[model samples]
Target: MSDQQKRLQMALDAAHMSIWDSRIVDGQVIDGTVSWSARGAALLGLEEKALTQAFRDFLACVHADDRARVLDVLQDGVQRHGGYDIQYRVIWPDGSEHWLAARAQVFTGASGQPERTLGIIWDITERTRQEIMIAERKELAEVTLSSIGDAVITTDPHGKTRYLNRMAEQLTGWTSQLAQGLDIWDTMPLADEQTGATLEHVAVKCLHQRQTIGTSAHTNLVTRDGRQVAIEDSAAPIWSRDGEILGAVVVFRDVSHERKLSQQLSWQATHDHLTGLINRRHFEQLVAGALHTAKEQGHVHALLYLDLDQFKIINDTCGHSAGDLLLQLLAKLLQSQMRDSDILARLGGDELGVLLPHCPMEHARQVGEQLRQSIRDFHFAWDSRSYELGVSIGMVEINQDSKSLSELLIAADQACYLAKEQGRNRIHVYQEADVMLAQRRGEMLWIARLKEAFEQQYFRLYAMPIVHLREGLESHDEVLLRIRNSKGDLILPGAFIPAAERYDMMISIDRWVIRAVCAHIQSVRDSLAPVEALVEQRRRAPALYSINLSGMSLADSGLQDYITEQFVQYAIAPEQVCFEITETAVIANLPKAQVFMHHLKALGCRFSLDDFGAGFSSFGYLKALPVDYLKIDGVFVRDIATNAINRAMVKAINEVGHVMGLKTVAEYVEDEATLAIIRELGVDYAQGHAVGNLRPLVAGLD
Candidate 1:
């Protein structure tokens, strides 16, 4: 080849192209007149000698599926005296299908008649394979997008909608055809569910930020027909292979049911289901907020604790259903009497709390009275019964002086209790002095009742068995004191002991108990059968009686002499009586207690340090006291089975008592679990309901 021809041939060879030429006659390619370069022959899988071939022969090499279209293109080019470019599949001699692209022009002579055609051909099987794969993937992606359940919308980088899936059409109430090319915000309008304010499109944010953006939980989509649909969605920017911003894809779904359920649970958590009012827990939060405002802004507020009177009577006369109806009616009445700013809540079981913000104490009292009157006037009718209800309200001002939420509530409750005590259907304002005055009044009442019991001889003695843990060890009874009211009801000492102690009557009560106990023991000794007397004499010791003494009695100089007189008068064995003194009493009157205990010890009377571990200084005071037994405080023994710290405390006390040569007793052993634990801890004696039920000392002796 010449130099220019060689360069042209080299360029075609570098491009992997082959040149071909053919003569055209009468608007058709001449048969047996087609020729091509060796590369073209090789691309067709033909021998070198096959470079020149008839037009029909070359057509034979074209794939059967593409041959007709190729021939039509060639014929049309020749007739139109124009050029054509086309791609067609070719089957090589090896039975492998390949792709080729050919371009040719129909050259015209001076007379404007078609003369010849020339073309360049190249193998495009690899590029064609890639294009096919890309088409298939695109088809698959379209199918997948249409099939998914979540509403999907694709937007251009400019935030204009490009495509919408089937779900998107249903959710937005807009067809894909109409949504195309529209702004994404217009197609999928959103607003805040709570505020009804327009929400910025997440797709726009994703496009701007070039990252994923999620819509808030409160977002609601405004459909085409102006209906709102709760939705949760996310938008992610689509990036091109070169990392350029292509568009964004938004995926969302309906969350109406979930949102509804969440709201219901939230409401139930803060509200009382029975009355539809806020519960105590939520009420406290609001009161705390009010308290904060009062302290910070110098604003005055008031809290009212209302307890419904006669509610229990109605509940007991009727069923709980009637009680519930009464409560519901009362709640409405109370709500109606309060201002819009006032918050009312059900503080559990016929009790309601009211919080009035920015109100003075006087105004709060008036409001409380109004609520009380409203409840008093409201008659509730249930199941053919009409009953009048009354409310006792306690009011406390919340101001800079307010200490804490809990203290305010407690003060209000105390005031309410005082109102009920004075008379029902009244409102009482809380004052610091109210608590002390109320306590005094209650103590006075208890004192009067105690004096009546003393004059009437209503005092009674009960005993609980204190059983020895080990076999063959003697068991004894701890004497407990009770009082009989004029109504013939038994009353435990707890109801009156504190008052008796505060008023200096505990010593009198103790003296009475000592004498009564001695007389009872003597009577029991007299009543004993001959066989029982013989058995008692044969035993190691007589039946022992443990008695409790007040701290005041312990300090009385003449108490020991009185006790000795009782013992001698009854001809009772001094060894049979044991005196129980609390840890606090001994600590309070250590010197006097020691002298009295030493005097009693000389007379063969035993002493036990009751409620030993309660003072938390048992070991310290135990060494100084003359005691035979250490009573583990019921506080620790009550939960010794489940509380690790209590168990450890009891164990330590028992071990220390054992080491000090004093027998250890576990008190308040109410259950098998507690009894088992103390037994396992090696307590010497167990006393409580678990060992034996409390019974009248006389009956027990008999």
Candidate 2:
């Protein structure tokens, strides 16, 4: 017990580091055993009884207003295990108010009653006041910076991130906790856009130099996950009152959108907004440069003047948006004809210019003819109407003998005018002795040839087998329509189909195929036993002959009636035929497509949505119309075995079809590996060159 009390007394003595006292409750003050030092008597200015002030007289020193609260706090602390602790004001006899911190512990008897109280008291007015002022200043600084608009960052002297404001955190893709203690340079990486190179550390350089450093133009900050953002900022050293550099502060703003706007404004100055091709002024500048090159360095070049034929007919009927789309599409086609070094531009409305450097007259003519034919073959679809248009291009070759750039441009324009006057779809070379011919003759020849072929029965039917993966020989052949030329040569359908489609000749062709397909089906049915025996193959799935229909035919009011008549005339079952429509055609004429599909479906005919997963693939129309098969586009199926992206696309399409209960047919499966991949992806049918080759639709009749 004595040892315990001695340790307790030592603790109280240590607590009185600056002032105060301790007491043994049973000791007598008159014995002088507890002497108040002379310093304590001097503090009170009383020598008599100064060495022996009763505890109540000491309470008098405590401010009267705080006496009751102090007593209650002490009583509450006396019941606890640690001690009684309080900070309160003390008023000396001289009326001086000072802060005092006091703490005490009470030792209890076996019955838990008070035995002896040991305590200490000290003055703490200066320390408490300083702490409160520091807290208020820190809070004020935090509030001001947090509300600032610009991004702010502060790093330590060692170039580690110490703080990041909200904007800074968003721009850097790093939060305060995650970025703190990380190298500031790594957190806010900067790159020189022009050179694709990293710049020096911003904060470290500022601290070393003790001055602000501004960033240069075309500087981009690389964020945490590697996105480059154009940014503008400056870094300055953070200094203390004594002019000692502590760390650095950086203020930056995101300028990515602003930079893009500036660049776009510059580009719009020289390029057409609609077609994104060089404008008239830029095209003329190129031609002028080409003429100079020919004169000074003996270099040869060519320039072409192209004017659209029948553009007004289509543009006036359809809206201007359609005309703009056609112009943009033609620009892409023109680009396909030239090398990257060649310049193609939209000279004006319905007119274009092409500049070919280091070219002879012969090569320029070929390119000019190629552009002319491409436009002649293109079928422009606009608002449920399809238009066939043409381009009349004039070629002018630049040589050392060329007088001037203005003269060459004039000659090219004159030749182009002649092409347009002659008929609209021909290319004319600006030769001194070249004769004027009627351009109308070119288009007249195609229309006349198509009419002759329709009368001569020159059109033929060919079918490529669509083999079901599980059914083997029990497959359908897709009926392809082809036309024979007068020379008895087999010209591919691509050669004449676009022209026919542009002129609204496909509906007639589609009718002929449906009629022929019925005959083909009947022939196969009559010889099924012998044919299967000849090929040594047995069928599993029911045979259905599939035929393609165009968007124009789908919207034709008379097409549905003509189809009904053909079905009755051929005595063919609707179950034996499948109508295939391109996805683009369906999207273009949705209401007509739905009505046509539903009408045929009512008659037990199957429908296959061909060329799905081609472009703008969407399930938005899937629920609107009913379809049996989703034919994967050849472009996607052709490379699934080797391409990861193709595999993902094919897998996604297959899953969507299966969910809708539609069988999927993979096209362009030309190899065994591709077939393996398609089969693994759960496609129901495989149709392509690998499955079968094109054959005469009527084998025995031919």
Candidate 3:
């Protein structure tokens, strides 16, 4: 061997390299021999005799899977380039495998004629094992990045995204291919919750600092279509092996589901579960906010408090299921009529509240009127019953200079009471000079006392007889509700009704009246003959009983059902029950009132158009109301004997009622002169002082 060959041999032996030498002829290894250092022999499991043969024979010892690839590389170099230097595989006698890196060169004569080739080999098993492990780990990392549950986005130094995981795709609604090479902030727009500023406000700061940053807190992210998705995210600088900083990698999870869950829980804390509207708790918060804004902005807000009129009648007459249906329908109707900015909510059982932000006094009135009109226009049906729902709205525009939330709410509630007092299906706006705050306070106190009376059944029924003017005999009696205070003084309807309506205590009073009237009728079932023989008591046997229906009673579609059930429960004949409807109510919701009237008439009950000629006397209203009697307004009756217009109105109303098969009754008749004029005008019944003083008859039949 030459000096260089001797030196290379000594170095290979000391380095513990496995070595081989091959002689190539005719493009094949003609002869070869192997030698191994201790470690190299362990890698290959072979000694010198194994390699002392044609290299092709030695290659036959390679693992079947790797043999063909190694052979191809060797053959390609021998034929195409006339030389070979490649790393490949080999097999030991025990069928185990190891890698070998070989270098070879062709030996030729001066004329360049092909001759045998010489080559040397080194075992590369440990190096090959490390490479395989590294490749496997790289594959696992790729899989993990692709399949992670939370969205992962990695960006370049320019804030341009370069990687997106599967979760990121779904959350952002973008595929990796589409998201890659795009600026992250531009791709996924996000905004500040308070100011609606872009989240990029801090992005440039993060990029310049090269410092890892977890977003200080959760912020609002907007999806492609502007849906707010809450997210928790953090960013960190990526680096190269040489420590050169790359872009940031941001890891984020769509917390929208979490946010929605929290919002749901929060909403449940302050909202009505059934209607999904703000409840009283939320309402208090809203009113407080409105009052503050009104104070700060120098603008006034309005509170519209609404009570469904006659709602109890519906609830009592129908089942609670029907009542629930009616309430849902009413909620829908109210919501449809309000603006998106208006704060509308179901306060509680048949009551609703509306907060009109930045609303002026006139605008509040308009809104109140709009709600009243909408409710009066809504018609609903259940089974064989059908009716329009009506609302009595009380509105109080914030006196920015004077009122607090509580004061404003009370004022609005008072106006709502007045609306009901005016016979329902109406809107009453609080005016500057309406009532003193102290007076409302006193009225509230009175309502508290009235509630006590209702609970204790301290109310009494006083009868006003309706005497036939010509026949000089009493026929029916109107039952007026009177309350006895602790002082035992009889308080009139006008004195306590407004308070009752305000507190929603009228429903109890109405129930008491119904029960008392029913019990009284039962008590008087057997006194007809003796009462008839009394000279002044002729034709008083069929004294039909009448009790005024509060507006709240009418708003309840169930109230009619309750009354019917009560009548049945008490064995009271339908003919003995008379319902009085104010002219204003009938016209306020003509369609709905018509439906209610139809049901009442179906029960064989009678209807009276009370206070006729007091409102807008549309001929259409007269034609529509299913009234059995027309009660002339006291205004017309009081002056009928003197004022020509008053006389004309009374005569015309009497004619219309008579023409329509209804009896005409004159109200407030006080003297012989007024009585004579009404009789001459063809009025059928006379009431008021002129007819006869009212008194409770004996508990017997006439």
Candidate 4:
């Protein structure tokens, strides 16, 4: 080779390039006239001797996918009389593919036609591979952003929108194409969910702060179509590798359904399902607030407690569904007659409460009368039958005199009871002089005190000895319940039993007594001796004890299970205990009482018909009851020695009880004379001060 050719080859080799020379005529390469440097031949995986082939042979080395394009570019360059740069793939002898870039210039003859071409060719496979990888990654990111459920938007550091995904387009109603150059605040308008005021864009904050920014709670998105949607959103700044802020990405999701459901749940919590009125719990909260205002701000308010009269008749005659419908209708009627400021609530079954804020006593009375009149005029129809309904309303003033919410409610309830007692369809205002109302209020107070007694274990058992009049029978004790007041003063059962019975709390009290008595007896028996003594006592006969059960307890379905559980828990034998139920209780619910007595009797426990002959003194009920003893009423026994009629009554009861294969016990044997009379009358037992004064059963056991 010449020195000049060698120098040129050296420079091309240093640049990792190759040189080519070809002869072209009329925009076409001539055959057998193409030549290339050794480096160019080496790029095609061939030796320099391979260049002896024609131009068509060299063209054959180009990849099949790129051969036609390479020919077109060469022809265009020859016709234009200018240089062309082209990139194409080539296949080596081993069938491996590589990218090649070529730059060529066309030389023209005197006739102004292309003659020869000179080009530099180099391999670009690595650069091409890197570019393909980067493009694939970018396409994958786009697809991922478009497919996600949450809306995604990207903005420049200046807070200008750059891209929006498919979800963003759907949520904001602005496509990426249209929002590309707009401000992010305009592209995604936001507002306060509650106030309906426009909110600043979170992306703006993210850009300024260069950190993640979360939207305030309860934010709404104002769409392009002017629709508001509840949304939760967060924006985070995008940072370059060198720690410079490049842009921000905002992610958001629609929460409209969640917000609506939350609101619905809140509504349901405070409303009564049957009447669509505020429930008692929420109403009491409002009344409590009013009471606070009355004390602090001297605001006058009034409360009305209304109970539907003869509602039980409707419920029993037409079924509870009809009663429910009637209540719903009455609620709407009462609401229509009240002012917007007044709140009405369903206190409980067939009962409602109304709060009149900023109203005087006279106005409250007028409102109550109006409500009562409306109820009286209303008629409820069911299944082709119509019935007229009436309301008894009680009004109480709320002022500085109102001490508490509970007291106010109790006062109103008492007044309502007074209204019903006097006559139905009437309005009664609460006053301190209402004796009946006072008694009822006292009973209500007893309910609270009784509940507290149970919680604090204030109730204690006391027993009075029942002396056995017949021979060979051991004396037993009759258990009585007494309560300890807050001041540690003992209260007799007479003070609280009536209240408990009236409020349907007798079953709870009876259960408490049963559990306490069983525990006491088991503890006493256990303490008297160890396992051997207990076994000996069981072998002989366990000491008998009597516990009083109220009328309500007989009707309680769970009471039997409760008593059985207590007996098992304390390990007390059924034969060691006797249950005493009043004659009134047995007669009031004869079937339930019979079932209760029979169940316990079958379990080896004895039953006594207490206060016998006090109610329905006839002997007919004696045949039906499965009782082992009849405790003659204290009234009859208290005067048996002096009163002939009382003596005759006790004689008749004892004789009849004996005839029915039952024993007769006499109560209120306060003197020897009464005791002597009962003994003469063949009474099997006597109980009262004459037998023994009351003493703590627990103390005796201890």
Which has the greatest lDDT?
1
Those runs of model 3 whose alpha carbons end farther than 4 Å from true positions after fitting are 1-19, 25-27, 30-57, 90-97, 109-115, 164-234, 240-244, 251-279, 320-342, 359-392, 395-397, 400-702
> Which candidate number has the best TM-score?
4
Give the per-residue lDDT of model 4 (tens digit) for 471-548.
544758899888877786666675588788888888888888888888888887777657778676666556788998
How many collisions per candidate? Answer: 1, 5, 37, 0
Q: Alpha carbon lDDT of residue 257, candidate 1?
A: 84
How many Å off is the CA of 31 in candidate 4? 4.0
Which ranges in model 1 have alpha carbons more than 4 Å from their true place?
Answer: 1-7, 20-34, 46-49, 52-68, 71-83, 93-95, 106-117, 241-243, 313-320, 436-702
Off by over 4 Å in 4: 1-27, 30-61, 92-97, 109-113, 215-217, 400-411, 414-418, 421-424, 428-702
Give per-residue CA lDDT, model 2, range 6-118, as digits (tens): 78656645753323443434332111122344434434434523375665676677788887777667555555634578877678767877677766676666766554455
Tens-digit lDDT string for candidate 3 (1-702): 999978987887786554544454554543333333354445456553332445656667777777777767766665554667787777778777778777766565565544554555677789999999999897887689878876677788888878778877777777778888888886566677657778762344467787888664457767656677778777778888998778777777777767666666577568765466788778978988888877787777888889997676676456444666787777777788888989888887788899888888787788888888888877778888787678988887764574676777777777887777778888888876556753675676786788678677567777888777667434688888776677756566766887788778877788778888887877666444665447333434455887777667766667778888888887888888888878776666667677778998998899887898866554468887778888888867865676665787788888978888998888878778999998888899998777666564332211
Candidate 2 wrong stretches, greater than 4 Å: 1-160, 163-186, 192-340, 343-439, 528-539, 700-702
Cα lDDT listed for each candidate: 0.87, 0.77, 0.73, 0.85
Pairwise lDDT winner, candidates 3 and 4? 4
TM-score of each: 0.59, 0.51, 0.51, 0.60
RMSD after Cα superposition, model 4: 21.7
How many clashes would you count in candidate 4?
Answer: 0
